[model samples]
Each structure stands twice: as structure tokens, then as C-alpha cells.
Target: MKTLLSAIILLSSVSAFANCPEFKVPKKFMARESLFSSRATDMTFDAGGNRIAKIEERLLSATTTFDLYDNKRQKIATARQRMFSGGTEIEIKDCAGKIIGKIKERVFHNMFDIYSKYSILDATGKVIAESEKKEILAPSFSVTGTNGKQLMKMRLSTFSTRSLDEWVVEILNDTQADPRILLMIPAFKTSADNRETEK
Candidate 1:
């Protein structure tokens, strides 16, 4: 049943983005495990292996700051998370430094890190989408729209190795969601899980 559902999502994603050539529909993206050293995450194309977007973390800062860039290395969006906060809060902005969206972590079943929830908000602080971590052995997340409709499903690719990990972003619905938001889902999972271990 899971495999069938995944196949349906793949077909829907390809069909929905087929007409839109301008936006690149990302199949998978790599996020490095940056714990001690400062490293950046890059989302690349599978065909030519060209980088489509990059996420960089700031050095020696109290709060976590991330800069998102495009293929041309142009700044597209930025995410900032404050330190010493109970709940995780990340603010996303456009290249012009305008607020675009925010990701707020929500409380869920705290038993064995099996469940988690996050709310994605637009500039006006309206909930545009919501993400929930699936309770499975392999890492997976389900993104739903404001109307409680599933929009996308992100799964950590099985081809991931020790050096790098890839996340497959599959669009499930016809709704157009910002790719940057989709990219941030796995990143949040990594960071949030790390936080839980520290406690």
C-alpha cells in the first residue's frame, strides 16, 4: 500500500510540474551533517548534476542562520533560528530581506522521538502548510496545506551513504508549494532530532 501511494505521488508531481518549465522540480537534495565544522547543503539536479540551490550556516553565532541560494549563486531566501528557545522557530526571507514564511515546531508525542509537528506560515503569519513526521523506521515527513490536504511527501533516499544524505521530495497534490519550503523539511528533521538527543 505504501509503495502504491508513493507511485501515485510521483506521477502527480511530474504531471503537475510538466507544464511549468521555469521552476525546476527537484527529485532529490543533499543535506550534509554539519555538527563540528561549518558546511553548506546543496540541492542538485540528477541529469547534469548541477546545483540548483544551496543552504549555508553562519559561523560562531548564538542563533542559527541559514542562507539559501540558487544555481547562479544568487541569494533567494534566508532562515534564522534563535537560541535558547523552547520551541524551534525559523524565519524565512526573500533575497530583498522580506519575510516570506516562518516554520514553528510544535509539541507532539515525546515518546522515543516517533512524532513531531511543524507549522509553516506566510508573511502575514497565516498558516500556509503543516508538516508532520511519520512514525516509521526510515525518516519521512508529510506536508499538508491549510485545508488539511496532503501536498507533498519527503523521504530520506535509500541511496544515502555515510558521507552524504539525500532526500526525495515528492509532490502529492496539484498545489504549487515553494521548493525552498520543501527543502527545509529534512533540514528541520535533522536539527530537531539533534536537539532532542542533547536533552
Candidate 2:
């Protein structure tokens, strides 16, 4: 059943953004996992199916780490989710190891919102964005910037989300935010949920 669903997701994702030769997708693209993919790695591809980046997830020292790579296989960024201390934050760093952004869990903030709420922070550790999952009429996930603009939107191929390890991402065309940081949000959120489930 899982394999069948994975195949469906693959088909939906491919069919979603194909047949447009004039459409050039660089920033606006999808990051997806291989069919029958485990939770180990994911590949980012443009609409033409050209590889943009690759993210590898690993467990190290009680922390879940996701390393991003370019098509050339050069490391670009890293996201680390600290499992200890209730796994409050996931830190994103550039290849230089400098912190670029963070995904923070909000415990008190959840009281007001039916869905889980998260704060996105820049390198300075200042909260600069917000994310919420909406399942109203159209089930979608959106990350909003400080200016109250949607940074990116992630929606599943099917209405049901089979796994957090895989996704269909579409970064808004007009967003001025860094794409590197935005891409890390999904993995961090997945790690956050894993931490919660373990508890």
C-alpha cells in the first residue's frame, strides 16, 4: 500500500509541473524523494527535472542532521535538530558552519492555534518568519515572512501526507527571503514531529 501511494505521489509531482517548455524553473521548483525512498535522502529538481540540490539526513549525537548539496556534490548547507532538551530548536547553517536560520517550536503559542505554530529565525537569532499548516478547503502549508507575505507553500501530491521525509515544495516567486533557509523548514519540522512522537 505504501509503495502504491509513493508511486502515486511520484506521478502527481511529475505531472504537476510538466509540459511547459517555456517555463524555466530555477528558484521555483520541487524537492522530492525517490520512489520507494527511505528517510535517508531527498533530491531537489527544477521543473525540467534537472537536479538542483540533494539533502541527506543522518542521526548524530542524538541530533538529526540534514546536509544539503549542490548538483556538483558540493556541500552547501546543514540543518541540525537537537533532540535533547525536548528538541526545542533546529539550527540551519551554511557550508561555513555559520548559523543561517532556525526553526523554533512554540509551546504556548499552540494554545491559540489549532495547528502547530513555529517561528522562523534568521542568523541573528531573531524571529523573522512564521509557518502554519492549513487543512480547511485546500490542505496546504505556508511559511510567512515578517512582512506577512507567504515565503513558500508546500502541498502534498495527495490530500494525505504519507511521510514528512518527502514533499512537493514551491517557493513563492516573489519572496525575497533566502531559498536555502526556506528549504530547510520541512526537514526541521519533520524532526520536530519525530521528537514529539518519541516523547
Best by lDDT: 1
lDDT of 1 by residue, 40-152 (tens): 33334332365666666663346767767666776677788754354678888766566768888765666576576888887888888888877568777888998889888
Summarize candidate 2's per-residue lDDT along 5-85 as a digit string, tens digits: 999998987675343222123645665654223334444544557777766778676667888777777677788876434
With candidate 1 superimposed using the best TM-score fit, by how many Å does residue 199's alpha carbon deviate from the native? 8.0
The lDDT, on a scale of 0 to 1, for candidate 1 is 0.65
The alpha-carbon lDDT assigned to residue 120 of candidate 1 equals 85
TM-score: model 2 vs. ground truth: 0.67
For all candidates, the clash counts are: 0, 0
Off by over 4 Å in 1: 1-48, 83-86, 110-113, 194-199
What lDDT does the true structure give each of the candidates?
A: 0.65, 0.63
Worst 10 residues of 1 by lDDT: 38-47
